[model samples]
Target: MVRREHEGSVLEAGQALRRGEVTSVELAERALAVADELGVYITRFPEHALASARRADREFAAGVDRGPLQGIPLGVKDLIAVAEAPTTAQSTVLDWGQGIDAAVTTRVKEAGGVIVGKTSTMEFGCGVPDRAKPFPIPRNPWDTERWAGGSSSGTASGIAAGMFFAGLGSDTAGSIRMPAAFCGVTGLMPTYGRVSGAGCVPLAHTLDRIGPLARTARDCAALLEVIAEVPFVAPEFTGDLTGLRVGVVREHHFPEDADPALAGVFDETLSLAEGLGATLIEVTLPYWKELTTAVLVTASCEALAHHRAELITRWPDFGVSARGIFAAGALVSGADYVQAQRVRQVVRQELARLFDDVDVIASPVASIGAPLLDDVADEAGQQNAEVFEKITTPYWNGVGNPVLAVPMGKTGDGLPLSLQLAGRLFDEATVLRAGDALQAAR
Candidate 1:
C-alpha cells in the first residue's frame, strides 16, 4: 500500500516499485486525487490510467522491466498528443480529431510511463490567461491567486502541486522555463532538433522545442533520457563543481531596475557555486535587445502563418488574447520575417563566441517572482506582463542552445525565484550537470 504522503521523487518512486513497496496503480490514484482538487488536468482518464498501471504491475511481476520510467505516472501538456485524450491546446479552435499520439507520447508509453491525462496550457501555446475560454485557468500551486508562468502553465503547476512526478512541456520562447520558474519546478529546454516535435501542436515551427518539468534536475534527466531522440547520458551530481567555469551574465540580462530581491537571491546562488569550488566570471551578452526582438517577430510570424486560415475563416472561435496575438503576426511582412532570421543568425554566432570562454552561462530566468493573477488578468494587465516579464530564456531559444531553469530562492511573499543556465548546442549534459550540482547544494 502506498502511503498518502508518497510524493516522492521519480527515482524514489521507481525504487519503491522495484522493491514491491508500492504499485503503479496506487501512484496513479494519488496523482488523480491531487489533480481533481487542483484543477491541474484539462482531461482526466482515470479508468485508462488504472488499466495501464495494472499492466505495468504485471510486467514487473514477470521480471520484465522497461527502465527507470517503468510504471511512472506522467501528464502530457494539452498541446502534445496523447492516445488517451484529445489535444485541446486549451482552445475551442482546434479540431479534437487532430489529436493523435505524438512521437514523445509513443516513447513514454513504450517505456512504461502511464499517461494520467492531458494538462492545461495557453491557447495554442501563446496569449495571456482568459477565463472566457472553456478550459480552466491554471493557477500557481503556491498561492492559488498568482499566475503560473506560461504557456506551459498546467504542466509546471501540476508538477509543483505534486499531481504527477514529471510531465512534457513545450518551449518556443520560455514557455517551459517561465512556468517552471513561476511554479518552483525545474524545466529543461533541450537544444533544437534534440527531440522530435511530431504530433505536437505547433506554436512556432522553427522555435518550438519539447522538454520536461519536474521537482529536480535529476528527474528531468531521467525523463529526457527516455524521450530524447538523441542519445543522452544522465550527469552525476557530485555536490562539488570543482572544475566547472560558470559565466555570470548580469548587466544586460538583469536590467538596472530589476527586482532587488531576485538579484540578491541570484548573488547568493553565485556565492554558493563559488563555495562549491566553481569559478564565476562576469560576461556581457551582445545584441540582447536585437535577439529578443528577433524572437518576437519570428515567433509571431510563424504562429500567424500556421493559423492564417483559421484566423481568416473562424476568428471569433479563438480566445480574445490568442486571437489578438495571432492577428499581430499578419503585420510581419515577408522582409521583416527574413530580417528577423538574419538577426537570429548574428545572435547565435555571438553566443557561440561567448561559450568559448565559459562552460555555461548563468542568468536570472525572470526579473521577479510570479505576479498576482489579478495584476495580469485583463488586457492592460496582460500588456504590463509583456513589458514587466523581462526574461532571458528567449535569448537561448533564439540561439538554439540547451537551457535548464532551476529554483534558486524565494521572494518575501514566498513565491519561487529561478536561475537559468545555458550551455553549448547539444551539450545538455553539462547544463544538467550544473543544474544537478545546484540542486544538490540546495
Candidate 2:
C-alpha cells in the first residue's frame, strides 16, 4: 500500500496524509527506501526530513495546515543550494564539506514543503556527465541502460521513479524538459524571470528558468502557482482542434535524420491533436538557425565570464567533458557575442510575426528516445547524441519562450516520447491549459 502511494500524484498523497492513512514520517521513510533501491538520491537528508515531517503531522493534528504542498515530499536539484546540505552539482570542483541555502530553499520551507534530499545534476548545467566526480550517473527509470537526459537528470529520474511526488529542476537550454521527455514525466520551463534564479548556479543568465517536474500537467500548474506567485486559471479551452491553429514549424518539427520511431510518434501526436479540433499548419520562421547560433555564442561568452577564475586556478578539479565545454567559452570573441545578440533581436521580431498567424507551435521534444549509456560512453556517440538533442531543443532557448513537454506516449522499447508546446512569451497559462486538455484526452 505504501508502494502504491509512491506512484500516486501529489494531490493523492496529500489526501492520504489528511485522512490519517499515512504519517509524514512513514511517507518520508518510504521515499528514502525507494530512492535507495533505485539509486536516485545523491544526498539523503534522513534526519532533516523526519524532523520536518514530524512537525507537519503535529500541525495537522492541531488543525493548522499549509497549502496543497503542506506535507508533500520533494527532491531538490543539486544546482539549487539548500542550507547545510552539500551541493556537489555532480562535479568535484566544490569541496563537499561546505554548503549554503538559496532563495528557493527558503521559499519551500516557508510553505511547509519537506525536501527529501538533493538530486544529481551535470557539472555546471551542461548535459554531459563527469565520472571523475564522486556521484554516479543517473539512470532512466523506464530503461536502466538508457540516459535519463540532461543536467537535471537525477531530479527528473527521481520524480519519475516515484522517489518523490515532484522535484525542483532548472532549465537553461532544455535541461528540465529534455530529461522530463525521456523519463515519461511532465516538465514546465516557465517564462524568464517568472521564477527567481537568485541563488541558482548559472549556465546562461538570461535564458534560465526554474520550474517543476511531475507526473501530470495539473500538478505542475499547482507548483507553478507556489513558485511563480501567480494565480492559475484553468484554460477555458475544450474539445476539438478545428479552430485552434497550431503551427508545425516546418524547419523545427523534426531533424533531417530523426529516427523513424520518433517521427512516427510525432505524427501520431499530431493526429491526436487533429482529432481534438486542432488544425495543423506548416510554416517557417526567418533566421531560425541564426537564433540558435546566437544563443550558443552568447551563452558560451557568459559562462566563460562567470567561471574564468575557477577554470584558471582549479582546472583539474573539473570533469574533463564539462571543463572542455566551459573552457571553449574562453575563445568566444566579444564582437561575435554582440553580433549573436543582435541576430537574437531580429529572430525574436520574426517569431512575434509568426505567432500572429498561429495560437501555438508544435514540435518534438527530442529527436530520438533515450539512447543506451554505453553508446554515449565514447566521443563519437557522445557528439552524435549532443547534436541530435540540440536540433529540437535549443531554438526555444534562443527565443526564451514558455515551453512545456508532456509525455505523449512511449517508444517501441518502452522509453518515453514527448510533444513540445510553445506559447508566446510570458503566456504560460495558455500553453498549460492546452496541455491539461490534451493530457485528459490521453
Task: Please tell me which predicted candidate would have the highest TM-score against the true structure.
Answer: 1
TM-score of each: 0.96, 0.92
The number of the candidate with the highest lDDT is 1
Q: Tell me the tens digit of each residue's lDDT in model 1 across 322-438.
A: 877777888889999899999999988888888888999999899878887777646542435444457667777788899999999998878889999999999998888888888
lDDT of 2 by residue, 1-442 (tens): 0133457888778888899998888888887777354346678788888888888889989988787677788998888888758777777776443356666677777767788998877788874665556777878888787778786887888888888898889987788898899888889898777788867878889777788888877778767767774444435545445677788864655666665677777777778888888888887866867776787777777877887898999998877766776777878887888888788788888889988998888887877787776665457213344444433677777777888899887777767888888889888876786677688787
Clashes of each: 0, 7
Off by over 4 Å in 1: 1-7, 97-99, 377-382, 385-388
Q: Cα deviation in Å at residue 439, candidate 1?
A: 0.7
All models: lDDT?
0.85, 0.77
Error of 2 at 284 (Å): 2.3
State the displacement of the C-alpha of residue 175, model 2, in Å, after optimal TM-score superposition.
Answer: 0.3
